[model samples]
Target chain A: MPSLLHHPLDPASRIARLMLAEYGVPVDLEEIKPWLREAEFLEVNPAATVPVLIEGDVIVAIGPLASIHAIEDSYSPEAVAGLFPTDAAERAEMWRLFEWVAVKFNDEVTRYFIEEKIAKRDQRGSTPDTGVLRAAKANLHEHILYFNWLAATRRWLGGDTMSLADFALAAHISTLDYLGDIDWGTAADMRDWYSRIKSRPAFRTLLNDRVIALPPQKGYADLDF
Target chain B: MPSLLHHPLDPASRIARLMLAEYGVPVDLEEIKPWLREAEFLEVNPAATVPVLIEGDVIVAIGPLASIHAIEDSYSPEAVAGLFPTDAAERAEMWRLFEWVAVKFNDEVTRYFIEEKIAKRDQRGSTPDTGVLRAAKANLHEHILYFNWLAATRRWLGGDTMSLADFALAAHISTLDYLGDIDWGTAADMRDWYSRIKSRPAFRTLLNDRVIALPPQKGYADLDF
Candidate 1:
């Protein structure tokens, strides 16, 4: 069995887990406490980032693209619920949206939340900074607006089919929602899109995720907000 | 003719430019001063990022990966060049390294340089913080050491061939070198590797890059540095 080095709260890790679950691939989840600076974890990913996949002797480390590439190359079913688009133009669009979330959204929101909340708490006595959080919250609002525009125009972020782009974005947004950072009332189309995504069987595992003392927002597990 | 929305000094933009020149593709470069808040450019990329490629009606924006993917898929020669490895595992490794430099290195080092230098200069009367510059310089030294380790172990960052990994790294290093931020003396192996990359025909345009009042370092054009 492949061993996935990850943290439950990490969006990238969550996305990887969702992909594995979607594919019906069993993987051993080894939680990595990045703050602990574990040497073994560092060996797998020299950069010491999470969501490192260890498959026998070959170790695949990096973000969504690398993980998605590895999983798709090895286990993607012919036509049943694949995460990537088969058509050339659609595939390109899928990649674009995947990158938009992985880089832009991740940078503008997820990393800020981690750095401000988790990393701050881990480094004891340090509290999350209001300034950084303020910037992140503002940026997130703009990001949601962009998502609203996309969700309003297209069937999905990429196109007609569900792709890695949706999972990548939902992973980040879900994590933020866990912290009550998301304002679902802002975009009706996005709210409807989230409603559909939240109902996915693969997302159930994510809905149950808890971070001790930081219980998810009241309606986190509910299908309807 | 294709239009490229870019900031010439941006490492990612520079890399895209190099890749286009290397492939003999002609592009009309349009400078988008990100700080200027140009609505027209922002329409092309909501993220307000550079190196956006406009091919006919299709607007492909974001980082080097999107541009690289577009170039490889559309214009690459029948015989795959050493720039992007043909082997699956090797290609994955190259992509991983590319991500490291494009995202990690760019965030850690390049952003600091931009925040300290250009942004500060643009906001006249606001001096570049010496402390931030010092920290960025220190952090950059550590990054070079890591690069030295890679140079010592592999023929190229992705191993045995010049790949996108090399270009990704060189792109950032060249940008820093232009501002005299890199201390090439820190790693001989890294310097040697860079010397080879600098001599490539793809690199000539980068060497001639001028960023207004910030002339490149003395050795920027010297092939034997």
Candidate 2:
């Protein structure tokens, strides 16, 4: 059995969980606040980041990107579903969009939103700064507007076929949606896309994630909005 | 023939170049300053990132990671070399270390150093901030120390085989070295490892790369150092 060290709201962790569930691989989830840099977690990953996958004896996949790739390499070929596309060009596009969500969207939106909105309330016990939140919301609006057009144009985020790009984007958007940061009404196509993704079996684990003190916003677990 | 749009000092571009060269894939280099965000470049990659590999008609690999993966998937297996290790565990280790250099080190050292030292001087035409440079150097010291110990223990950064991890690391280190940022004397084993990489055939084109306005640091091209 594989055990995943992850945070409930971490986008990368969500992606990893979705990757596993989509491929029908069972995993034991061990929640950890990676920022805390616990001694045990640090031993497995010096970087102190989450989504570390511990599999068979002496086989550990540390960090988000590495762990995701590890799972894809192991069970993907024989699995009924794969997160990657079969075609070379489509696969390249899939990777390109994956980087967009992981690096660009992460820098511009997810990290900012988490720091200003989620981190203050949950971890630091500090007040959420409206000024920073405002700026982050503006960034989110820009990206969502772009995604709205993108979602309208394609069957999935990358192309006609669903890939890691879809799940990765959904992971980030889901986090923001949980915090009541997204304006679904304004994002028609993207909203439609999200609603479809929300109903997937892989997304069940994520939609059920609750932060105890900081509950999810309205319609987070709703199938249709 | 493949054409690569790259910036001489860009770590990701350097990594792609090294990957192609190691696999004996010749590419016509087209230098681009990504910060400019030219209309033409945006058409290919909306992110305006460098190291976009343009191959067969209609086949375009955008961004550094995507382009590297593109080259690896196409020319790798039987081209006398491959960037990935055959052993599953070793490959996992390679991806882990590759991410370390791509995400972690780039965030900590490369971006900060480039924004302060290289980008300030080259792109913005402004004086490099000594204070910011000082902080970046401190961060680099911590990472290099970690690499030094790891390099001393293994034949390569990702264990026994020379993998993408080595080139990814060399890409970033070479960039900093060109800008005269590294203290090679203190990084004994790492520097020794770098020296060996510097002599490789794939490293030749990188050594020959010259920016008209900016030359490399003292002993930058010298392998004996």
Going through the candidates in the order shown, the clash numbers are: 0, 0
Candidate 1 docking quality: incorrect, acceptable, medium or high: acceptable
Q: lDDT, candidate 2, residue B28? A: 86
Superposed by TM-score, candidate 1 places the C-alpha of residue B160 at a distance from the truth, in angstroms, of: 1.3
Best by lDDT: 2
Per residue, candidate 1 scores C-alpha lDDT tens digits across B118-159 of 767777689989999898888898889999999989888889
Q: Which stretches of candidate 1 lie over 4 Å from their true place?
A: A62-64, A86-89, B61-63, B124-126
> Would you give the TM-score of chain B in model 2?
0.95
Clashing pairs in model 2, backbone N/Cα/C closer than 3 A = none
Each predicted complex: what DockQ? 0.35, 0.73
lDDT value for candidate 1?
0.80
A93-180 per-residue lDDT for model 2 (tens digits): 9999999999989988898877766656655557878888788889889999889999999989988988999999999999999999
Best candidate, DockQ:
2
